[model samples]
Target chain A: MPLQNIKVIAFDADDTLWVNETFFRKAEEDFCALLEGYMPKEEANKLLFDMEIGNLPLYGYGIKPFTLSLIEAAIVVSKGTMPIELVQKLIDIGKKMLEAPVELIDGIEITLKELSKKYRLVMATKGDLLDQERKLIKSGLEKYFHHIEIVSDKTEKHYKKLVKHLDIQENEFLMVGNSLKSDILPVLNIGAHAFHIPFHTTWAHEMIYEEINHPNFKSFTKASDLLQIL
Target chain B: MPLQNIKVIAFDADDTLWVNETFFRKAEEDFCALLEGYMPKEEANKLLFDMEIGNLPLYGYGIKPFTLSLIEAAIVVSKGTMPIELVQKLIDIGKKMLEAPVELIDGIEITLKELSKKYRLVMATKGDLLDQERKLIKSGLEKYFHHIEIVSDKTEKHYKKLVKHLDIQENEFLMVGNSLKSDILPVLNIGAHAFHIPFHTTWAHEMIYEEINHPNFKSFTKASDLLQIL
Candidate 1:
């Protein structure tokens, strides 16, 4: 009954709609292996994570920012002695990630297809505008949504703006995605319904230790499960 | 009478609303100076421009893309001989540019304030989402606009979508900006009014040698000049 008033459903792009974090995880492993000569794999990965968090305020989110942070972290881990070829390699890694195929989450297409008929669906992402737009088009799922909402970050304020832009009230909006920090918590805090259908892998940055228990919140393990309730 | 039906005036950010291209030009000079040992300043500048154009489809527009292109161009110019310190300098240069203060165009605040009273004002740009949002807030010009629209590029298709999103007819939308190619030409092609206020320094990439003469087009030398006719 809580979702009865929902007129718009916004789904987070990255891991929510496609296989994103798995690719990032693979990239991180490759990065750590590349820097193994300078630092241990675990240490180098941690350093890269710290570098990304430090740069987040300025760089926002995307493969490009991640690539930039990788270079910066390599510099620090290698003590400013990284070879030029290695730097070039890091740049290529970012581009390859950008060009990577969008592997749709299992059953996401049918889920979106079913929901589109009854609700105004939107793909919301806090990723690079061009990169996400490319993925949306590549996924062959653009036709399912009315439009895409790309934001720099998904904060409560941003959610409020998104709802206002949709010309709907907070209760009339529903957010479905993988990361609780980005797609669920802030949305739930804003008096809207947030249903979490988490991806198998989440970045350490998006991990939360606490369990979520909110009146406007629901949790599901797979995308297809949404149709059972919504 | 031509402008009578306009309800929303979307102003292009960057050089149109503030001092943007000047900063980029200065950054280019500094970048060339850093690579002077490997390539001539003129050649280095041209190479950087070429690198940017080549990467545009993948990277889109914004300081982040420009920064990434800078690093890529430096690698090619130096031919793998550039020291790690130089790469670090390029990274630092990008951060400094991102952190640079927003300098509003002369008399633009007054123009925006005056125009906001009678029309729905929107700040639209093809810049990074966070960067443009920061500039708008820093310029103290956010209050004058109804909302901000960030797009990957400004083409006729993009303008059409913007007008549709604003829930207005083509003629009811007006675009004002410094780049004739970006803000005026495509806008006119879409049957919307486009007012061009030339910025003193235009990016070589945005330069269009052909003069624009369209029924929906008008050119101005400064931002304040818009008040006279609109």
Candidate 2:
């Protein structure tokens, strides 16, 4: 069946807009290389991941300046293998992370420009507040969106707030992104239609979530290809 | 300050008890190299991430024999440049990913050994059922807990079902992992105390969810360090 009633189409900003994971992934590799003298990559990453996960409650998601976490993780993993250079290396990675310009996803602008005409296109992404806004504004894609929802979480509260903020009906909305946990599944749970467009190299964290067994949820292989359903 | 009423502790398997992201991340690096011959690393990754984000509704986590996705992506990124050797290279990377072993986090065995003395200790992880179960069983760490809850997702319904399967109380359960999106956040929502042990180089697909902002949710840098709280 055609997915109609999707009056509000929300897009995830990170991988959906540009690239998010690989940049961080590259920085992490560099971080590990710098720490190779003190600890093996596997040991060092385990420690780093432990610290990052533990600190999520305090730092939230994208608001987290991961450089600090990277430094702290180095110290923890070093276990007194103490080194000053590693901390500096993490700082360098952070600079690279922020200074990196946004790279638009293939066919994203073309699809958005086209979809905006037929639907009330809104950007519903979850990430650090300023960074996401910066990306949207810098890409010049911000103006086309009727509403922009940048949230740390995409729980029911996050979705409900977006619905209210945008004055949208849950049934008339569609959320798209790579994350089943954050995008399709949750949106489907709330009586909204979600068109999942998964990315490659699915994060282990995002990998844990399962597909929704529902009538409303749908999926596509590419952003431009989503036009048929839209 | 003490974690109370906790009888059973469940751990997310993939990167929780063991190291998996590193291999995946490494595989991604190799995959990108293979694709770069046809498309820029940036463009190749953007397309891969985009395609991955699209598959969540269809695949739903556990690094599904993702060779199909990788092959499909390479051809798309090639835009007619895909050569047989490159396809073979991509297959080789996919094979490496499939063969990557689950290396446990340092000190996990020691810590879990201690925790198992006081708690029921279930491995509440999700993945390819056989793969997840195999990783656990082969690790020789499978005998530590009384329960093993392996499934595709861990929503309220999933958690509730697992709890029923294990016959545990709401206040007595704890979920631990590197992703707040999966391991920490959902458990907290369902009236349980979750331990967020963040991992650097977490999977990109993992939803970077917001905090519960509730009192019962919790986190720690080291599993051994959890002793201080208890």
Candidate 3:
């Protein structure tokens, strides 16, 4: 197998490990509904998305940033006349998302359990470190991974640093995740192997409208399909 | 010296290496001033502190959490009748804090540069990973350390994990920081060496009233004082 030389396997945590975007989607719907009087639901949702993108560099990502954006967008949508209770509701939505239970992706546990036997596994994710660590513990999957690598953003430079930290060559590192933007392209660009397993919903910010055809890249329909090869 | 066995030195980032609490102090002042119309500044500041502590378990520590708490506290202080402009101002305050310049504490650079020659230096900090990394880059202190270890909290369990991750024994790890609660107690409790360097200002939430009398611990008046012993 082309992946036979892989010594360290890193998995992206959010959608790849469990249900994340679904909660965000739900929260967005709730926000749009709350402000439907001021603006159309679709338009309000788009505005909130734009606000999030604009704040990405300053706030990074997580429920807290999203909650802040929701509050700001509400103010803009309502022209600073919306009830202050709406702000509280947005904060509650963000808190609820943080407290949401972990829902493991199908066959992910078995996939991790099987793969952990042959290679060193790590959860390489970009978000709030606290939230990711809490999720890993709640998922009861913490034991399967060597450690979690929490980054502000995943880029080629980060991948190179990860490889160096793990004391392995680029060719010996394999990254498996659902996002082509954060996980796959960076790893592949660094001459490491990357596997893509698409999730049901992709955050618009993480969407890349392009076909990837690389020697070090592989795409699978589901998590368990990896067992067929390495 | 008792620290002769220490092979790795992890420094706390916030008030230890640079000015962090001062920013929070300034933000709290601005927050209280904004709501002075609804409540007295002292009472408003106290209420905001209470709100932050209450949200700690759910929100963890960072500027984003603090910003959310400011907004929530504002809502509570005004009983949900505050102007939307105030909310926007709170958001702006948080953004400015994130973009604030990194002011290196006096003698911190020389201390780190000197320590790096004998021990593996790391920034073992409890904060948002991205924010900490950014500060390290801005402080121009990233070059002196081996790597950065960012955690949500600094409990005994977390310190133990850090020591294990460093591939060293308990005695071989030394922690130096400002807070007795987070940086000192936890590290010493885990059978590692810890040094205390008092900062000019301390966050009320991180305050400890008791005197520590650990054999493996040493206290210093400033950052450069560390160079005298090591």
Model 2 TM-score, 2 decimals: 0.49
What C-alpha lDDT, on a 0 to 100 scale, does residue A130 get in candidate 1? Answer: 83
Q: Compose the digit string of candidate 3's lDDT tens values, residues B191-216.
A: 99999998889999899998999999
Error of 1 at B111 (Å): 0.7
User: DockQ of candidates 1 onward, in order?
Assistant: 0.83, 0.01, 0.87
List model 2 lDDT by residue over A1-230, tens digit each. Answer: 54666678889988887878778777777778887887898887777777777755434455233654675676666664544444445555765675678888777898899899988888876565445656787888987787555554788866876776567788888888878888877787788887777776565556654546688877778889877757
Candidate 2, position B212, lDDT: 59
Give the per-residue lDDT digits (tens) of candidate 1, residues A54-165.
9999999999899999899999999988899999999999999999988989999999999999999998999988898889999999999988898878999999999999
Who wins the DockQ comparison?
3
Docking class of 2: incorrect
Comparing 1 with 2 on DockQ, the higher-scoring candidate is: 1
- What is candidate 3's CA lDDT for residue A149? 89
Candidate 2 TM-score on chain B = 0.91
lDDT of 1 by residue, B75-175 (tens): 99999899999888988888998999989899999999999999999988989999999888899999999999988899998899899989999999999
Which predicted model would earn the best lDDT? 3
Please give the distance, in angstroms, between residue B156's alpha carbon in candidate 3 and its true position after superposition.
Answer: 0.6
True contacts kept of 2: 0.00
Better by lDDT, candidate 2 or 1: 1
Please give, for residues A29-148, the per-residue lDDT of candidate 3 as tens digits.
999999999999999999999999999988898999999999999999999989989999999999999999999999999999999999999999997888998999999999999999
